[model samples]
Target: MNIRNDQYTIILLLLFFPSLGISQVEFFGYMETEYDWMEVKESTYAFGYNKLRLDYESFPAEEVSIRGNINFQTYHGQTIWEAFDFLPFDSLNINGEAVHSMPISFLDSIYMDNLYINAAFPRFDVTLGRQPISLGTGYAWNPLDIFNQKELVDPTYEQPGVHAVRLEYYINEKCIVDFILSPDTNFTQPSGMIQVKSNVASFDYSVNVARKNHLYPFWEDEDTVSTHRETSFIGGSFTGEISEYGMWGEALWSLSSNNSAGDVSYGLDHTFNNGLYVMLEGYHNSLGAEKDGLYDFHYLNYFSGETKSLMQNYLFSLLSKQINEYVSCSVFIFGNLDDNSFMYAPQLSWEILQDVSLSAFTAFSSGDADSEFGIQNQSFRVRMRAYF
Candidate 1:
């Protein structure tokens, strides 16, 4: 066996063998199948993925516990077409003879190699190895995460970063403060930071500030250097239930030594007596007059791509109803006041068996600039899932 596999097996045995004399070991996991298709304005593609996760949590002491999670994925067919031809190839030739060979890129191999480890103690947690960092009101941009994942909602959002150490101190039942520290390494620079979060009856808030000690090269443009680019983000959100309806609103402002941006968003979700539910959401990035610096709204960072300009106004709505105990249907539509790019989604789901389900999802997009999966979005997918 390989070194890593040997280590994993050892850890698994240690976790269960020690509990044999006292208690039984606990096992947990989930399975999911997701199929997605993209029909852009000028192009289209289809892909699907399945994954499984196994984990164990054991307690040797009342206040102390060790937990581990291992996950893997099985991918189906994949393909991509380039708009312009760059690599010319008649055939794989060896010594001037034709031969068959497959081409691959960094991304093509990443799905097969994803692993992580996290251990927690009283009021503290430390995660070592590769992982993903997701936090804050900025759904698309996570300034607080140094090891930010390239895709906002990418199921494989896990990225390589330094060992993350975090601590939480409870001030009371409604408030708690936490801090996270991670040292820069080969993949990232030495970085450290802290944040404080509070919760009230119907409101939640957080303040985060951090520093990336060294001037780093910008990811969007490798040649450009982001020197002494001290950055800070302030964000908060409020959510409450009113007369059987759910409502929430959030705002985020990003401030850096060289740029500033703001965002305001609100949403309402309600369920009817007939087992039907509806949701309404709206957002305004800025006045649209102009800002001192660029504000990106893509899944990743602004540098990666231009932010979606909703023409100062954008609204989205969704309706869903349960057809029966084992089936359901839903539709989602989002548009702007100016008829810019729009989006539509129709979905159907069915329960295959206990703890297992299957679903189909389709989408269409058109208009002015919207989110990344803009107005030119369309796709179909089938999925199966199980949990324990």
Candidate 2:
């Protein structure tokens, strides 16, 4: 494996952390192997990877603490996984021009997913460096979160840490104000977010505002292009139990020089006394395209980590049950309501032994050939993980 300069920084820091006194430090991590395969019409593509993540936490002083997670991952047989293999489009369009060949850029590098030092004061907390930033209450989708994206196959997977500084000021036990800054290399076009969150009765509520000079790709003048734009967002979210059923919702109004749009998401979930669980959610994006104008959403602003679908309307449902203490299964159904395309995914998980788990997931798509889910015939993925 070839190590780059940035990888060296993470390696050195991990090596230096222990010298400060191992007695006060705690280390934990996990090793995992995952395989994924997909069928698109007559062609099938698959790949597998092994990953090792090590996390460390240390308290340097009464109010100061450090935390980090170093990640090392490698493909099973080959390093490069061609992006075109998964994109719905071909390598070349009708105009004989290459498209959808974007590089993943970081698949081969070993890096720190998170590294941060936090200092707690009497009334507030300050965190600096690369760290995890998450907000909003939607499980499968989060409209109020402008900082990160979710993966459809595994929505709960750990997200990559971002270079940011954060602050939290407490108003009381049930309320707080937060500010976050993600700076740019040029320093002239940075991103910032501020939020005020509070709990009332059986609900938690929050309102937020954010601004960023975002880099986005688009289809303009019949060609593809990428540019930077200054955008602002105002939004709110709430999560709570209503009549013993969990419910949550989020909404965002996105404004830019060219246009303004709104995105909304809401979900409801409940568990029965017999251990059966059910959930339903919906999403609507005023900026999304229609059936006649459908294309890859990855090129749109939402794919920059804002939303999940290409179309303007979508729905998701889930049913899950625990068979025993060590085994559970779930069935999921989601669709692009505009394109009339749907995907059904069933997942099964088993804890075979202590600290070891295995999971299997499979999906089937249904719709017209030109529809979103119809681009893929079927797919399956399997993963095994062990924690230490």
Candidate 3:
């Protein structure tokens, strides 16, 4: 069998027989159903999906542990016409005949999101396999996170894990260090990083250095081509509190063979005595475009892994209030200061029952036609989640 099939089979066996030969095991996860309405120009699209996730962890020995997570999702809604636009010509043909039809709404998939093993030593810890890694003080833009790219628009959302091996060591009560290595399919190309963390007084600080391959699109001979180049990055972040207010900042510098880019982010947050919280943040990206229309294409090519904007400057603000023990509401605003475009998102969440939550959110954008948030007029979403 192929490697993919083998991986699935192993996950299935683990799920069915989690307690076999294991000293201790734990299983937990959540199920979620969501409905979304999106407006692109004058066209409106309605979509929905149901997702179920299961997480398992076992400790077979004092020093050895294993963890795995599986996710299953089924999607239903309007036909995905935009997918056909990007499909290759060969993909549209079957048995020497061109398939001109697309499925309206019928797809389901199951996959393993995390499969990892951990070992604890006297002075250090080691983890190998697919896992989640994030490092930075920036709430919206995490330039220092070299392993997993995050969705800046919704910073609290969970991101997909990456395959890598990580090693962590504690030097003292306030000092720690980490090393990570991730090998690509080619095996010859590997990406990795080293980080040092420490705490002094009331401030937490971290420094990171990494080398990774970056893919960029370039125009050559009237055609767009993608090229991979090795880039070196060094970054640092710090978080501290001034009186009753929290403050944080992060900066990263990337050096390439021909060019260099830098990004910096800073933020301040405070919570009132009445349970009201507010945050304000600013980010500057040296690699982003200074003008608006130069990066208009990003609107059409936006995805989860990419940055939300290609403009240089951004301002983000958030306000949240807790109504009671089980209900909360928040509003967030992301503005492209360079282009004078902005997006506002408001959300409400409630815990209606034990282990169950309901949330509703909507996003509205306004600006010129070619501006960042103006491409998609508005969007609404409602989700229900149950954890066990």
Candidate 4:
């Protein structure tokens, strides 16, 4: 382990030592690799990336719990700087004669520093610290959500971490209530956001209201840009599912006041009896305007810059078959409705041992926007995962 890894390990031990007497401990992690041979540039599919995480969960007492997580990523070339601006240095060079240099930035720290605490009561459960929160169910397009993912929506983890409190209560055998409250600042704002969700009869619904306070820095000046209400979104969602085919559909709407912006979305998901799963989702966000000019939906700003929104659409299909107790094969396809781009992945997975599995996967994408494929993008990745 390096100095950074060792330091974090020590911290983890110290934090959880006091509760070890009655606590339960668990470990988990996974590894993924991608070979990108579909770039239009000189870059090969070998952007070389790997991520590892160590998680510690302790249930010291029946009502209280604690969890800690550390995530590590190693990437080569522009993939690290371009895709994620977490690092301050523009580039990294490793040569035979030069010492290694690294960038220091706030986001760089977030890459590995994450923690949380959970407390459970008879009627409600509460969690405090940095965690993920997603309000709407629209995969690539969550108009009602100020947070969301893009591209392969089903496979993308779009939500950013927030310091918040979450509450869940079992209203009855068929009903439950869920809510969240978070502090928002330039680094973290949103004095608080709350949602009330309930499931009754054959339908489920939720209503949420929230405000976000943000600051945008001029890319070059650390102190030049003024801090203002970057954006605030308030929204609600409604969903329905049928018992027979287990098909479900949902609609979401978010009203924004800062710039007179708002968005709407609709989605449907279904699973067939033959181990086939399919989903379709769409969204329209009124973030741009025009006269004879054209207005466009921009999912990138409200959520994150990583997302690109137009007449966005997403489709997910998965078919899995179990060859035996520990082996299976799955075929998945993800496509964008507004664009002619899609990814097809067929994977065969096997259990290497308890809590350990190996998988061989091949994927290819077709679309002009995706650099992984040509006019039609193509790439392959294989992953190994272990969990407990």
Candidate 5:
């Protein structure tokens, strides 16, 4: 079908059948605007964007429900040096300039971020359509999540949805199982996973096995190419609390026909009586580099979306406190132990009104030029958001 036809069909369905067996409906969303300034070496940059989202949920029946979200965004920016150091290219051009820039105009897209439906039964539930799926216990690194991969630096951000069908079954009061099927290329080559979760004593745990497809860097003699490959993954995670401290751990092993890799991550967090909160996390990837001075053009092209860092070992720490009823402050540090590079980000937020907030943040890096967090020198951001 054509794109225009698909859009028309969706709009018709939304407008013509507003009360198709629906018992209740709810609507909500948010609007946000942000401005950023960045300094990389001798170059300075500016960026700004505004985003609007609309979300709706409806209960069609006692056993059925529907949910969806639509997003609209407009942005304008110019960058003299690249804002992201890990991207495949150096700088992007917009209008005959060696800088990243987007004019202030509406994007030519009415994005449907999520559209899904669910049906529940006594012992099992079924979900179908484009939806978000994530599975893991670790806060910083989620090695066990096979679908909807997340960026560790901004773990709380919302992820895009994927088309899939999922089935969940309850075995008993303490155990449950899930099965997911996601199709690729006309539903012939399907990928999926099986997960079993249980509560043992005071800890909650899950084990998963899956078959998935990914893109990898392939070398043929002197030439390099990005090739598609299939892999099998096995992983598990556990979360528990000891006294006032919370702890979580996750591990994953990936096996291909020719190579195998693994990763592990763990975290600990605590909240004091005075409302001070702190967290620490550690991560290790067997497929990552063990030494410094390894990132180059080829490395950037191969690992842009696959990994966050080239180093094998990493540590993350966060400290946050609520100064008053309307203000809060936080600091986060990310360290690459193998290269001795670190990034520090500090932020302050104020609740301007009941449904509005303002925030300011700054990020700085310390390391040599060749190290991971050193390419992008510093950046600052100010954002305002209103929830409706």
Candidate 6:
């Protein structure tokens, strides 16, 4: 979501020409603004940004539909942020101090986020062009999704669209077969996925297979060529409610040219009668490392958001409560099981008007100075969004 260029906006003017007097056309969007303040061990800095998102939806025919979303953003103080720039600490520890070096330049961009069309056939539905493709049921980590990564701070935020074609066939009322294909030029081969989803008893289950071309994502070297690797994935997930609590689990086995790895996550959530909700989840990655000293471990993956943790095992939990009808509060904690590093974040939100809301959040960490969570900064943010 932090992409700062809009060179490929796809045809902004051409798409509008066809929607001109269409009876089924609809347009809606939102405006969002955010301000952040970070306090490192020695320095305090602040930055802010505002975004205007415009969306369009049209039903040109009974069986055909088109949707598009465009975003315009402006920044203050800084415009381009790389790995760990959101925090005061970045990758490549020169000496032993935290470094915050963000470039300042063109502080605005008009980016097209999504544009896609879908049509219904006799026995199947097809979607083409850039669209959203989400997989897995894990909240903090999604092992089954090889194409996109989630942000630990805002896991529920929208992801950048994938250029692909998707087809879905309904075998029965409770079963479906899905196929997704994307011809990525950066990969040695086209990436694709096949998923079979079904509901059994009271649980929903999915089994999927995917072949993807992956890059190292982020490395400290500036001259690093975009190295690519072909990876295969076999995964499954199940979601259901047993007794009074909700339960879900996802597992994936990854195979590369030279190695094999596995990732798994399990989560449980429940809401009490007193209007309080609690959730707990655990994740393990076979590829992650464990050590009391984090200097040798690569921080690029975590800073670039490919993974949320740098250790092999982790724990996450959340507690939320609703106060009246327009205000709510929540808190979540994440910990690295091996290094004893933990992060605590709390937030409060208020809806003062219809379709508009404001939220405030703060995050701090606890651990040894060189541990995963130790070198982090205490940060605060205030955000407001209004939907039309």
Cα lDDT tens digits, model 3, 247-315, are 999887776544466678899999999989999999987656667445423432333234334778989
Q: Candidate 2 or 5, higher lDDT?
A: 2
Which 10-residue span in candidate 4 carries the lowest summed lDDT? 288-297
Top TM-score prediction, candidate number: 2
lDDT of 4 by residue, 16-69 (tens): 567754666776655544333334323343454555666677787778777766
Model 6 per-residue lDDT tens digits across residues 127-163? 9877888888988888877667776677788888887
Give each model's clash number. Answer: 9, 0, 0, 10, 0, 0
Q: lDDT of each prediction vs. the true structure? A: 0.54, 0.79, 0.76, 0.54, 0.75, 0.77
Where is model 5 poorest over a 10-residue stretch in terms of lDDT? Answer: 100-109
Per-residue lDDT over 121-228 for candidate 5, one digit per residue giving the tens place of the 0 to 100 score: 999999887778877887667777656656554677788876789999999988989999888756765778899999887899998888776544353213534354
Model 2 ranges off by over 4 Å: 2-23, 77-79, 91-107, 215-227, 255-258, 295-308
| Candidate achieving the largest lDDT | 2
What is the overall TM-score of model 1 with all chains considered together?
0.66
TM-score on alpha carbons, each prediction:
0.66, 0.88, 0.85, 0.68, 0.84, 0.86
How should the candidates be ordered by TM-score, best one leading?
2, 6, 3, 5, 4, 1
Clash list (residue pairs), candidate 1: 184-189, 184-190, 340-367, 340-368, 341-366, 341-367, 341-368, 365-375, 366-375
Worst 10 residues of 6 by lDDT: 214-223
**Candidate 5 accuracy as TM-score:** 0.84
Estimate candidate 2's RMSD in Å: 3.4
